[model samples]
Target: METNEPNDGHAGNPFTQVPIEITISVGRARPLVRELLRLKRDAVLPLDRRVDDPVELYVGDKLIARGELTELEGDATGQLAVRLTEVADLRDGL
Candidate 1:
């Protein structure tokens, strides 16, 4: 016996191109004591990482990419240097 498949003409392909906004996050670590003693005009705090370190990128709180900090025309930007991890299912959906 053969099975009959339903063909609605659009069941095989049901996805449409759309614009999506990706939210990114950058992490910075600093001393706990410095945070506790923060002043209005004091600048004695030191960050845990250097300026050359890569920043973490996130999508809705999920870590997705890691990239280095870049300065484009004096504006700070995050350059996608590496893709640490990605959602395989999400890629397929796209």
Candidate 2:
């Protein structure tokens, strides 16, 4: 889903047009430093997610929502994208 920029003067200066980093978390793993160092090309470190599971969308370290991974349709880059499924409540703080 897309969010429209606030145009009313009520939404002021601090929230400028600057972009924020958005990270998609496929899953997590706890690999030791030794194990990580041993990893080289094609060494698959399997994440805690299955192929069909929904991934998390995070801003900074907070989980603001979740989404499903999808292919970028009609894009030559063949890049991946996410379609948001759910948005977390700000008061609940994830």
In terms of lDDT, which candidate is strongest? 2
Window of ten residues with lowest summed lDDT in model 1: 79-88
lDDT of each: 0.54, 0.85
TM-score of each: 0.43, 0.73
Model 1 residue 45 lDDT? 56
Local error of candidate 2 at 31, Å? 2.6
Tens digit of lDDT per residue, candidate 1, span 27-69? 4555677565764575555556666666666667655556665
**Candidate 2's residue-wise lDDT over 1-94, tens digit each?**
4349655563657756578999999989889999999999989898889988999988998889999988886744578889999999865565
